[model samples]
Target: MNYMISIIIPVFNRKEYTRECLLSLGKQTDQRFKVVIVDDGSTDGTEDMLRQEFPEVEVLKGSGSLFWTAGVNMGIRHALKQGAQLIMTMNNDVVTDEHLIEKMYYWHEQKPEALLGALELDANTQQPIFGGERLNWLLNTIEEVLPTLPKDEQKGLHAVTHLPGRGLLIPRVVIEKIGLFDQDRFPHYIADYDYTHTARRAGFELYVNYDARLLTYPEESGERQIRSDKNFKNYYKHLFDLKGGGNLRDFTRFTLKNCPAPYIPFHLANGYTRRLFGYFLK
Candidate 1:
């Protein structure tokens, strides 16, 4: 039988974080998956370290800076060409639980219609980082309020609207149906959301495996954290408008109401709005 899954990891100059990420992959309990690391031109010894430590992972070479979407596309293309039926794109900074692959695969097997399946990512300090959420209005992104303790330490399952790309698993069928990620609109940030939204529109579902878990490093997170940066809001507002069309206005409002105050809507709004005006000015 073909490989059940391919874990695609795209790395840049962040070898420090990539090291931990690779180690966690090494510790996975499921062995039905192959690890493919796409090094997007790292001058900071990331390539050397991967050569030494993760020789087994298929390494794809790229220029130093292809951005997140491009790098992910490279890795995904390689995985598909190598005969993987499923692809899991993970961030280089996060380390996952051992049963992550097994749980995710089970979810996919049971629910093949789930186009995007993600795990709950916690802060390195074990704080709740991302587990998907209902869109918020004011913040304009998914909210992560309380830390949803580790799987072995958790109770019941929780549902969410979108999946986090940091540890997201996508089946080959879904990718074929929806097409690969859009490289034009998003070089980073919100691109995953755009991809998921497209898949959802195409009759696919997005979900979270409450039992699958991972850890990340989030510098900005806390209660009553007010991050209404005009610059950030304006930039992303224009980005969404250009890509998502006028629907972005309402979409932005939807995001703000669902996402946390400091993270979503505001920051993305600034970025999208700025890009929109810049386009006309030029």
Candidate 2:
């Protein structure tokens, strides 16, 4: 299918990473996609570098406040205006596989109505980290179940409750209907989760295409909110910070929206119990 697939990449000051990502995209066997990069408040000459090296990529500006969620939305909106048939949201910190587009296109052709995401691997180790994820209320954790599957078994589209924005592909129709990510509530972390959950509620099936894989830098991506080094005072202060990964308010809202109503209280308490305990004990 020679559809107009626009790849929307939200970037900050990571010109090198974005360059590598674009280079990888340039090498794809299926080069039928257009790349729209949202260079939000990049002071590191990222925009200039892109304009020079990757002249084909459409570079869009963002208000300095625009984080990952809003940044991606900027690109998505631009793509929509440009008459894209499919919109694939990506991060600048990843080097996509040569077959990423080809495989995603294949699965998309197979399931046009369903939302698709690429299986993400660690750039260095080549280990699958985020193939697909689901909110496991019983365990009070967001589980990456597809990556745990054996290599031979990870071939087709594995249904998932949520998908990361790393290489998430959505048909233009879905975005036209369901709308953009909730940056006001979840600016960065878990924004993709909330969007996917909303899409699921709106009668869209989400899946991870294992055959469509991309290599991403886990270290360079979002930071750990519950890290040992982060002091309790700072953690509490930023508990509701929009950019903080899986922060309290966003997590609560997501759980309320996605989890079973009966399990919500226990689910939230169970998850927060460890978080609160860890900080207090420390």
lDDT of each: 0.67, 0.82
Query: How far in Å is the alpha carbon of 254 misplaced in model 2?
Result: 1.6
Q: lDDT tens digits, residues 216-235, model 1?
A: 76543210121223354444
Error of 2 at 64 (Å): 0.7
| Root-mean-square deviation per candidate | 7.8, 2.4
- Model 1 has an lDDT value of 0.67
Give the poorly placed runs of model 2, Cα more than 4 Å off: 138-143, 225-230, 278-282
TM-score of 2: 0.91
Lowest-scoring 10 consecutive residues by lDDT in candidate 1? 220-229
Number of the predicted model whose lDDT against the real structure is largest: 2
The CA lDDT at 190 in model 1 is 61
